[model samples]
Target chain A: MSGLKGWREIPIGGLILDAGNAEQYKTGSWRTYRPVWDEGKCIHCLFCWIYCPDSAIIVEEGKMKGIDLEHCKGCGICAEECPPKEKAIEMVLEGEGKGV
Target chain B: MGKIVALTGNDAAGTAMVQIKPDVVAAFPITPQTELMHKFADAVADGEVDTEFVLVESEHSAMSAAVGAAAAGARVMTATSANGFALMWEIVYIAASNRLPIVMTLVNRALSAPINIHCDHSDSMGGRDAGWIQIHSENSQEVYDNLIQGVKIAENKDVLLPVMVTSDGFILSHTLERMEILDEEDVHRFVGEYKPAHTLLDVDHPVTFGPLDLPDYYFEHKRQQVLAMEEARRVILEVGKEFEKLSGRGYGFLEEYQMEGAERAIVALGSTAGTVKQVVDALRERGERVGLIKLRVFRPFPKEELLEALREVKVVAIFDRSHSFGSFGGPLFTEVRSVLYGSDISVEVLNYIYGLGGRNISLEEIEGVFSDLQGVIERGGVKERINYLGVRE
Candidate 1:
């Protein structure tokens, strides 16, 4: 993560950046959505807490918890790790104009 | 009998593609090129042709589908323009590298940043290194005829390289003109069924396709592609001969008009060559020994033929539609100079950039190019900067 800023210098020749035409990015449009914990349907599985790539999902006490949006790029790893059949954690679109 | 009908270049290409009866047709619609696909769809729906038409979401996907189909030993066709071609840039290389005989119609348009959807050589010129056999058509008739012949050249067992038949967008693609349409059986016999040397879907004798080659093998693979392109030079001429026998219309790598005893010649490609020829004829009527060389096949460039054609000429003016910025020369001009390097011809070559982003290249502007060439010939060398016709601040 510390060296991630250097990736901007990489050339993706086909990419076009037009300042006049700003793109609209809404949350939850990704085909593979990331999940956030609600604590209401926690079964103490702790599955999502272990599998997060960024380790953004935090589990307090004996139950599962929500994501820390500060570091999460919404890759959906935690949602995929969650074993609960009730599927307590869900991925939803952010409010209009809200991205990620 | 030779009959004529008015049709856009896109429509002409689309009509030819449908008549060819390819096994799979996949393409993403970009302006100018969109009309080609639209016309193709209409033909498919009307049962004018029997083919599997896959409507892909993007040019990248379109090329991917084409590769997939070609790998399955299907005769495939596709099309794109400008940024769309840029999007498929990676796969365009892949198609040629894997020896897939995919025939594509490129409606030459300008790549965008300031956002232009008009005509230029920028699109195909950008993909010049992609290893596809490239042909530049000067009119709707050439576009139609080349689409049929390109398939033959590409699908030849000895030369299994993808072929791109290009014509200027809007200028050639949308302009209606009377052109001869070949009989279906004649085209079918001329092109024949594409029999690939290898295919992915052959379950009985399975072989790997597009494996990640190490450095040692990668160089050889590139060498093979080069050999295939060189083979294309012979295949194109052979196919041109067969097509002439069937259609009674002669075709060549480069078409020269009134070059006999001429001191100066103007060389160009695409629709602008038509205008240049008109200008040359007008000048010739006035006793100016001027001629025009229209390049029909650009890739596997007819270097030897060009040298032979210009061997007696004193001056050559090359009109380029796309400029290689910062190089201070056009792509075609650079290649021409390199080809003529150290040759005993001693002919002076001048570069002229014209019709960028669909700027109208009138007969008068072409005459101006010739006049400039004549001035250079008289002066024994070019004194002014490389001419940029129709450019404004």
Candidate 2:
């Protein structure tokens, strides 16, 4: 509420006046759980990359690198879609060791 | 300055619509209002206008498409009556809240439970608080004039709220009468082209409309609408004066007829005002002190003008064509009474709900209302505040 706009200061008609302002919103604050990647157990099949709902799974040159915590809502779709045998991606509680 | 021709209210509205040449029109057919769109469709087929006519399956979709077009920076218009108006209730609010200037012709009709399809104020009266400027008409002439003027009022930069120009269903919609129409070039110049400040089609500066307005700012947006409505009061007058220059007939929040030294008056709206005016003239000839207050605009409830108009009258009867159902009196009655409550002038006000489901109120019945006002004056007070006019009971 401190940074929220007043009725007159804000744009008229409840319109979002700027383009590509989604990054400024930082919806990552909504996450309560974080995904942890096990690089050693990784086959890099890229299933987790394909399954990330927020497009938070960072990939480069057709290979999975790691998860981008800036967005990642911790939905765990990547963890569930990862191969059961590999189990390279795991869901962990937020604020746990290296889980932030 | 314009050509005089005989046409029904529907045709007159269609003629005005063709002259305005809105960029888009989305509508569904309904009783009374059906012929209006039919006439516009005929115009579209004949290539008289270059509007994109979207034939939607339902009134809901019609309003939805109108909102989309208006948000996309197109001049949009539509028409509906009664049940059709009821169907479009959701998007109707959306169009106004989004501050889109979509003009709609609301043919006044009875809302159904008994499934009646004739003239009544139930439909538009129910939508009085929907954030749209409501301009009521007394005849085909007003129907034609108000529609053209509605465009300028709705699109006024200071007031970008949607406006509904209403005419009585069947009474005005079906009845043919002589009225003047401005030249196509004159109308085109009067309304000018619609240039919205922000639009969804602006590619360089992309913007989102109708976003989720949470508690943080919902109240503020609503306040903005209130301010716009306040501005509309002045704009309606300015536009009316300018329109009078072109058409020689002026308009305002309400029209006062024969109020000079009047002891009694009747307040009403729509075509019923036409009947009341006849009664006022006949009564005036007989040397009876009576008058008629024809309320043309009901949205911005003209408190100051009404107070001045009713100053000299001792007692007044407000004729409402629809009922408020379980309320103490009809909608107009309540509002008019409230306006006079704290004023320095003390005028006894009575409520009469009449003509529901298109029940006709004859000239004699109107005279009887004035006579009833005489009785209230003689009795020194109103025995019954709420009276049903022409009802069987």
Candidate 3:
């Protein structure tokens, strides 16, 4: 978040100053849809984490910690990639209840 | 603290590499440029240097490996000419954008269609806008000297951009020249060690290189590279001064011969400057007031210096060895004319694109160029701006 002034403030190359700090970018603002996860149906296949373009899926200690909404761009990739008979992950409008 | 040596341009560049002992060298063979890498390979085999040589299959892989090595905090060197340089086009921009201080010896040659292995500036000129600090050399000595300074200039924190030292292919690359090579210790001291500001191998402080930047930050990052180029102009002179302390040669944005109180002058680059200087001297002896400006650095184009150099001249001729087809003038001419725009300078400037594809540029052609300048001055204006010299009509 610091030193994000004009283009001059960035380091000489495109070196990211805040190492591994993609969260600061707040990419979630770019999302028009949100993904709701049902832990009950999760097989922990981690397919959503593997498919995430922004690495926005949160995985902690051999268990899925749901989605990291801070960095997720609401691309619906996680829900599309979720593998279950009924689909554990579903996409929904920002103000709407979790869609089927 | 120097010794006189008879060496070709390629051998001299190889000598510089042997002296510097860069951490890694990734290069492939191209005519006129191949011998340089051959010499380096011999150096490595002979244990003259411990440089890690990546024997890449093509110039593209050569440059790609160079980018990887440079990003990993290793000082890297490479060499190529013409088509080979063209092959490295992709990683060339990435290397500069990633702020890797990769030093390259770009043997100037024409691109192919008829396919020739000879001298021309088309190769490097095509790469002129690729964000590398370009320094042209007139001979083997300049090639050697420029490489020594290029390392320091590119690695400087304020700059941190790639630098390419070029000499005319075959004309300088193969021809023998008398040179005063500095003591190995002196060259080593002058080049110093390349300490990158941030590198991939710096595991303690991890860094991402060439990250995708959207509209929110892409424009600003490019602006920083622009500022770095401006900063390089200052660092180049500074590093040249430091190199002068070790070796007697002082490098600058451009080299001026005569024009102290001249009416007309010729602007050129690379080894052709030597030939132009000879013509200038001959014309001067015959009471012709002509001078020459040999552009050494073309990337951080010395506009202000060029304006100052030609301030007293009445008529100027800019000769480019490369052609920018469908354009008003060649790359050098286009940039030079742009700088003089909107200025109050009372100088008539003309552009001449010649010697493409290693065409022989004789002294007669040189004299004819001066005669045309005289014609332009007498007429008080020029009808044609871009003219070719020595081409069959």
DockQ of each: 0.02, 0.76, 0.52
lDDT of each: 0.82, 0.92, 0.89
* Candidate with the greatest lDDT versus the true structure: 2
lDDT of 1 by residue, B1-393 (tens): 446778999999998998798999998889989999999999899999888999889999999999999988899999999999999989999998888889999999988877888999999999889999999999999999999999999988778889999978999898888888987787888888877756667766555566645453566567777778888999999989988998886788999889998889988999888888788888999999989888888898899999988998988988889988999689888888888998878898888888888888888877787788788877877875477888886
Backbone clashes in model 1:
0
User: What's the best-to-worst order under lDDT?
Assistant: 2, 3, 1
- Runs in model 2 deviating more than 4 A are A1-3, A32-34, A39-55, A59-100
Models ranked on DockQ: 2, 3, 1
- From the highest TM-score down, the ranking of the candidates is 2, 3, 1
lDDT of 2 by residue, B333-373 (tens): 99999999989989999999999999999999999999999
lDDT measured at residue B194 in model 1 versus the true structure, 0 to 100 = 79
Residue B246's lDDT in candidate 3: 79
Steric clash pairs (candidate 1): none
Clashes of 2: 0
Where does the lowest 10-residue lDDT sum fall in candidate 3 chain B?
B189-198
Off by over 4 Å in 1: A1-100
